[model samples]
Target: MAIPPHAQHDTHATTRRGGWPTRRISVTALLCALSFIMTFVEIPIFPPAPWLEYDPSGIVAFVAALAFGPGTGAIVVVLPWVLKTLFSFNVWGHLMAIVANLALILPAALVARRVRGTRGLVVGMVVGGLVSLVASILCNLVVTPLYTAVGIADVIAMIVPILLPFNLIKIILNCVVTGLVQRPLSQALSA
Candidate 1:
């Protein structure tokens, strides 16, 4: 690569996709670890729905997504939930969760990447939250009804009421925490 004679710094640069970058892995691992830790500390917000709960899994996913990209974020988001679903063996819930994670993380990461400070995190969180909110509504109003035709409707109904607010909190908290942590972590990891 030829350097610009007058360049103050190396403007032409590319990320090291080699060896998965130890630094990037550390950040991803930290967030992944945090995500696991949050699972046990679930805060149940019981009211509109008995199953309403606050889960920080999204935080880690969002952070990873921001640090890495939507692809990483999607996997990070899916892994734990997939683990949970596997253990529970609830196919319906697992499917919904997979869909939810896929919907939320990309928008959050995209927004997060656009800025470089607290504002970025806020934007990511907002975008993730809105995306999740809209997705939940669509799933609730459309997908679930169709899925219920077989034998899932009752279960879907039980989940719908909880879906909106649960996801709202999930995305917001995920975005905020990931946004906050990812910045410093990103700098540290990337450096």
Candidate 2:
């Protein structure tokens, strides 16, 4: 049997050279560990909801997604989340956090893979930021009441004043920081 021309050409996009699967698995594990550590290093930047702290764990998954692919990036997000939940026992929070992380990562990685180069990355991040912000808002609106004693009215009230700004700041921070580091990291990984 013969491989198609397009399939042969695109194989390199999906697979790296030299022990490719092993390399992805190892890096995914490393990224997951880093993300787990990051959860502990958060700052209470949002005063309206001080409990809604800021952490850069998303960056680990984003970088992994940018380098290896979405599946590996997902492993980075999920494994840490599962382990963290085992200790914290916050199942709903963990589930929602996964959704939030994927909102940014999926779009950015998909765009980067499809478009290529710095331009693709920038466009992807911008789109991902918007998507993440919206997803965060929607998730908070829907899921906040389930976790908290607060009513839907109170949740709605907090959306603009609290959740919106909090998510905006977080998404922008992720975008800028990840954008700054992604190129160098990609080069390093490829090398």
Best by TM-score: 2
lDDT of 2 by residue, 1-191 (tens): 45455344334334443234444556677789999998767788888789988889999889989988877778888889889997898888878788888999989999999999889998998888889888887888788889889888998898889988988888888888888898789778645
List where candidate 1 sits over 4 angstroms from the true fold. 1-19, 22-30, 142-163
Residue-by-residue lDDT tens digits, candidate 1, 15-58 = 32223444456666666666666655668765776555676676
RMSD of each: 5.5, 4.2
Instruction: Flag clash pairs in model 2.
Output: none
My TM-score estimates for the predictions, one after another, are 0.68, 0.86
TM-score of 2: 0.86
After superposition, the stretches of candidate 2 with alpha carbons farther than 4 Å from their true spots are 1-20
For all candidates in order, the CA lDDT equals 0.65, 0.82
**Model 2 Cα displacement at 81 (Å)?**
0.6
Q: Which pairs of residues have clashing backbones in candidate 1?
A: none
**Prediction 2 global C-alpha lDDT:** 0.82
Question: Once model 1 is optimally superposed onto the true structure by TM-score, how far is the C-alpha of residue 54 displaced, in angstroms?
Answer: 2.2
